[model samples]
Target: MIQVEGLTKRYGERTAINKLTFHADKGEIVGFLGPNGAGKTTTMRILTGYMPPSEGKASVAGFDLLTQSLEVRKRVGYLPENVPLYPEMSVVQYLDFMAELRQVPNRNERVDEVMEVVHIADRAESFVSNLSKGLRQRVGLAQALLHKPEVLILDEPMEGLDPQQQIEVKRLLREVGAAQTVMLSTHILAHAQELCDRVIIINGGQIVAEDTPDRLSAQIAGGRRLQLEVDGDGDGLLAELRALPGLSSVRVVADGRFEIETAPGPDVRPLIASTVVGGGWKLLELRRERLSLEEIFIQLTREEAEAAAAAETGAPLAEGQAPGSDSAAG
Candidate 1:
């Protein structure tokens, strides 16, 4: 388990993280989602005891991060964005060395156990430099688990791998996270959606959103989208649908299908169906469209950026204004 309250980090005049607050419960996988330069690495470093925060309080597994830094480090396993590895050492040898460094009991037995957990026992004798990028990543993970730490903090665990490798690593992470708490930092929205039980999105050194993927999607969607297939003149149906109250936008996907965007309100499905029937158009199919994690991520970050810009310019943001529109922040 981990807890951070008002955590702040700075590099001279620049604040890397600002008044950040969040927590991960025992055996939960929490994703730290952010774009480049969003201070994810800084936060992770502070949590792992690799660096000290300029202000605020944090605890890991009941130990205070500041006063009990050593105890905190002993319970956390960190795999940075770029894993540090020895090129000449074989996989088993490297793991053995890491186990010793961590003061793991029965170093040889621990090494074998971790190698098996990461599925690198097959390459136990291969030089780290000789292995593929994916294999090397596994080796890095093996080292992290060598001591059976209580929490795993991973930064971009799938950074340089191919699609297949990414999938493989995701599977491994799911298995490892079953019993241990995991705090993963990644810009890959899809992977975060797949792996995290809860997500904390950071932007401009601040937390913009925190919740489960489904809840976040529902919150950002605000409006509903519908796709309908009608048997009639496409242009005529498009015009009629556009005339409906609360409708925002309409697009024709093909000869018989139309995509409709609507504001959040009462059910419009009945209205849409009746309109089609009233116009003598045969309605074939109708369904609501679900927003993907990527769409939700983009919308939340854009809104936060616009709100921040508005604050800086002493302007009031208007409802329904686009993010970069002059009316929103000028």
Candidate 2:
């Protein structure tokens, strides 16, 4: 488990993290997502006790990050975006050394276990310098797991890998996630959407959104849409559909098709079908139109920028935080 309160980090005059607050429960895979220069790496470093925040406090596995830095370091496994390695050391030797560095008891068993976990046991005897990029990444992961830390702080863990290697690393992360709290920071929205139970999207050194993928998408897009095609004058039929409760806006598109928004937490397809039949219109097609994660990400980023500008001008953000939603800006 991890907790951060009013976490703020600054370098010179620029603030990298501004009053950021969030928490991840045990056995949960929480994705940390943001655009470039969003302070994701900064936050990870502070949590790992590699750096100190300029303000606020944090804890990992019930240990204070500031006062109990040593305990926090012992409980967190950190895999930096660019994993530091001793290229001269063989795979087995590197892991063995890391195990010892962590003061892991039974270092031999721990080294062997992690090597197998990351599937680099075959190259145990091979020097790290000779391994491919994918293999090297695996080695980095193996070293991180060598001590069996309670929490994993991985920054861009899937970066620079081919599709096959990405899949392999993703599978390994999922397995590890089942037993430890995982805080993965990456720019890949699709990967986060697939692997995370909840996503924290930060922008301009602050949290702009945080929720499950489904909830986040619905919140931004104002709920999902249902596209329908019926054999009739779609114009009047669109109006009739809009008149129904739980149905919001309706647009009649080309080819007798209509795009409609439905109320949250309700299935309006059956009602639409019945309405079409009553209107003497034959149904042709009907299905939900879900937005891609990329679209959602773009929309959220733009919104955050606009909100930040509004704040600078002393204007209230038209869409500050939705009810029951956490939204912040620089």
Candidate 3:
């Protein structure tokens, strides 16, 4: 478990992170998502005791970050964006060194366990310099898990690997996250959408949004379309549905299928079902379409940037107004 409150970091007059606050519950996999220069790495460093925050408070595994840095570090396993590894050391040798440095009991056994977890036991004898980028990443992960920390803090764990390797790492993270808390920062939206139970989106040194992937998607998209399959001609049904209150638009997809768009509100399936059954049409299936995480991320970040710009220029944003243009917000 982890908690942060009012976490701020500054270098000279430039602020990297400003008043960041969030929490990762025990056994929860929370994704830390942001674009370049969004203070993700800065926040991770403060959490890992790699650097102290300029102001704020934090706790890791129930230990105070400021007063108990060592205890917090002991419970956290960190894999940085650019892994710091000894190129000349063999996989087994490097893990052994890390285990010893952490003062882990039964160092050999722990090393073997982590090597197996990351599927790098076969490369135990290979030098770090000789392994492929993916294998090297595995080695980095193994070291992080060597101590059996309660919390895993990963920065870009899937950054440079091939597709297959990325899949493999995601599987490993899922397996580990089943028992330990995981806080990972990644640029890959699809990966986050697949692996994270909750996502925190940050921009301009502040948190712009935080919620489950599904909720965030629905919130940004505002409304969704419904797909229906019936056992009769859909032309009559389409016209009738379009005439329903709160129904925005209706289109026939095929001889027996239709797509219905609705205004943002409660589910309209009950009304649609009653109308179909009452009219002697068989309602086979009805499903609502949801937006993808990519679409949600783009819309949320762009809105945040536009709001900031509006504030700076003292421009009044109209009620219910959407963002003006598609700019690279990140």
Candidate 4:
């Protein structure tokens, strides 16, 4: 329900978001995963018609984001990073006001329905000023969904909440994604992996990687990691493991735990096991693990940053090398 093409937003000479082109389909939950200042909020604002892009065009729910801005706003539910709330107003009052603004049918009942939908009904009588950050987020979400828009765009929806609150919000988001287009921006890769049906990783104001979590994980893993939990201190083993042939790198994660990376090819478990056994160390745990979503995110962003730097340095990346890699292995 969202289509963006070459969307560019510039602040004077600095580009906030550059040439971003992606879409979120109906009944899909797409996440924009990036670090701070990676242009996620800028892109969201442009899409929601809160701001204009310096270049390119976008549409939301079949309405042009530029020309048909009002219609786009009508179909989009936006929960910005800092939700604008009236501290003096109660939850119900604030939602009632928003409902009136949207001319919602059955405004009162719809307000209550959305409050329940976001699990903020118990605080209906409480003033918005009295609510916690999580509660405030719920209120903002309630107002956004007060009119049941076609698309939901949330920026950093789970920033300050405790684990329990995060779970509650995640559940609510999953339920909402069942019918509407849900697009959220977050720096948390784990959250994106758990929540998004499709993830688009952004960095340096550009698209880094976009794919399903599983596919991205498998593709960008580059090399597989083997986790080892030694019975005793693995500090000294770090050097020996790093010197091992066919291994990318080895580091002691904890006093007794070590993580080893190996290029994707032959299975090296037997050789690693023998080496550890020969060292007279008790191997408590040894298993090959796929790269986590967080690792993939870091790799993609790092590569993008490196590539951007290389471009500025008048040097192009090598063949088969990652976007910004200085070498094939880089």
Candidate 5:
């Protein structure tokens, strides 16, 4: 478990993180999302006791992050963006050394168990320099889990891997997260959508959006979209659909096909169907359109940036409202 309140960090006059607030419960996987230089790593460092926050308070696994740092450190497993490893040391030797550093009881048994858990048993004899990138990432993860810490903080766990390696790492994370608290920072929205039960989107050193994937999707919802294919009169169909009540926008794609968007909270499909059928137009297809994870992420972040800009210009804006972000439909 982790709790952070008004967590602020600064480098001289520049605030890398400003009054961030959130908490992750035990046995939950929470995704930390932001663009490059968004203070994600700074927050993680403060949480792991690697650095101190300039203001505010934090606790990890019931221990004060500042006052009880050692206890907090002992209960947290951290895998930084670049893993620290000895190139000449074999996998088993490296893990043994980490186990000793962690003061793990019965270091040998712990090393063996971590190797098995990370599926690096076969590479126990392989030197760190000899392993592939995927294997090296696995070794880094193994070291993080070597101490059996209560919480896992992984920074860009999927960054530099091929597709297959990404899948492997995702599976490993899902397995490890079953019983431990996981806080993962990533730029990939699809990864978060697939892996996290809840997501916290950060921008300009502030919390912009926080919710489940479905709920986030619903924020831009209620706009009825339809892909319609007909046997003839595509232009006429587009014009007719645009004129129909509740229909806002219409686009003709190919021969006798159109994409349509209805007004918020209105279902225009019945009108389109009845009109097409009554006018002797044969309807070949019809379906509602959906927004992708990337689209949703972009929309939310763009709004946050615009809102921050407006605040700096002395323009008053509603709290938690981002420019270009539609909070009306969903």
Candidate 6:
């Protein structure tokens, strides 16, 4: 329900996002993953019709964002990272005001329904200034849902919530995703892992990766790793496993667990298990250990930085120098 192509935004000589191109399908929940200042907010603002891009085109819900911005806004619900709330207005007043702006029929009834949906009914009379961060977040959500838009663009929806509150909000988002296209923006990998059908990872204002989480794990990591443990001679098992064909390096991690790497291919767990058993060792654990989403994110960022450096300097980044790290002399 959203499409962007070569969407570039600039302020003077600094580019916020460059040639960003991606799409979110109807009824699909896509996570927008990026670190701070990585142009996530810039892309979101353009998509929500909050600002116009310096160049390129975008469409939301099949309406051109530039020419048909009003139509696009009517079909989109936006909940920014910092929600714009009228502190002087009560929750009910704020929502009622938003509903009227949307020209929603039965405005009061719809306002109450959305308040209840976001579990903020009891706070109807409470001033927005008096609500807790979590409550204010719910109030923001209620306003976004007041018009029942087809697309939902949420930035940091899980922020300012306790664990229990996070769970409740996640449930609500899942239910909403059942009928609406959701573009969730957050740097929290765990949240995206739990809530997104697909994740689009961005770094340096460009898309670094986009795919299902499991597929990304397989594609980016280049191989699957195994975390194995045996209640016996750690050195002997490590030595023996290293000798096995098709296996790569093995290193002992915390708690005496052995982390082994192998090229992406057939299962090797059965073979490892048999070797441990044959040596009279008790197998405690043997399981696939793919790269965590956070690690994957770091790797992508590093790659992007390396690519950019290569393009500019015709050389790889210096060893031990992290992406975006300062040089010795600045």
Model 5 C-alpha lDDT per residue in residues 1-330, reported as the tens digit of each score: 899999999999999999999999888889998897888999999999999999999999999999999999999999988676899999999999988989999999989998887788999999999988778888999999988889999988888888888887888888878889999999998899888878888876777778776666655443545677788765566667767887878888888888787666545666788888777788777665556556767876777677666775432222332123222221
Q: Which candidate is the best by TM-score?
A: 1
lDDT by residue (150-207, candidate 1, tens digit) is: 9999988988889988888888889879999999999999999999999999987988
The list of candidate 4 runs beyond 4 A from truth reads 228-245, 249-259, 264-286, 312-330
Ranking by TM-score: 1, 5, 6, 2, 4, 3
Candidate 2 residues lying further than 4 Å off, grouped into runs, are 231-275, 312-330
lDDT of 4: 0.84
Worst 10 residues of 4 by lDDT: 321-330
Residue 259 CA error for candidate 6 (Å)? 1.6
Clashes (N, CA, C under 3 Å) per candidate: 0, 0, 0, 1, 0, 0
lDDT of 5 at 44: 95
Q: What TM-score, computed on C-alpha atoms, does each candidate reach?
A: 0.90, 0.84, 0.82, 0.82, 0.87, 0.86
Clashing pairs in 3: none
* Candidate 2 residue-wise lDDT, 301-323, digit = tens: 78777767777534222243222
RMSD of each: 5.7, 5.6, 6.4, 5.3, 4.3, 7.4
In angstroms, give how far residue 106 of model 4 lies from its true place: 0.8
lDDT per residue, candidate 6, 130-226, as tens digits? 9999999999888888889999999989988999999999999999998999998888898888889999998878777888886666555544577
Greater-lDDT candidate between 2 and 5? 2
Model 4: number of clashes?
1
Q: What is the lDDT of residue 264 in candidate 1?
A: 65
lDDT of candidates 1 onward, in order: 0.84, 0.84, 0.84, 0.84, 0.81, 0.84
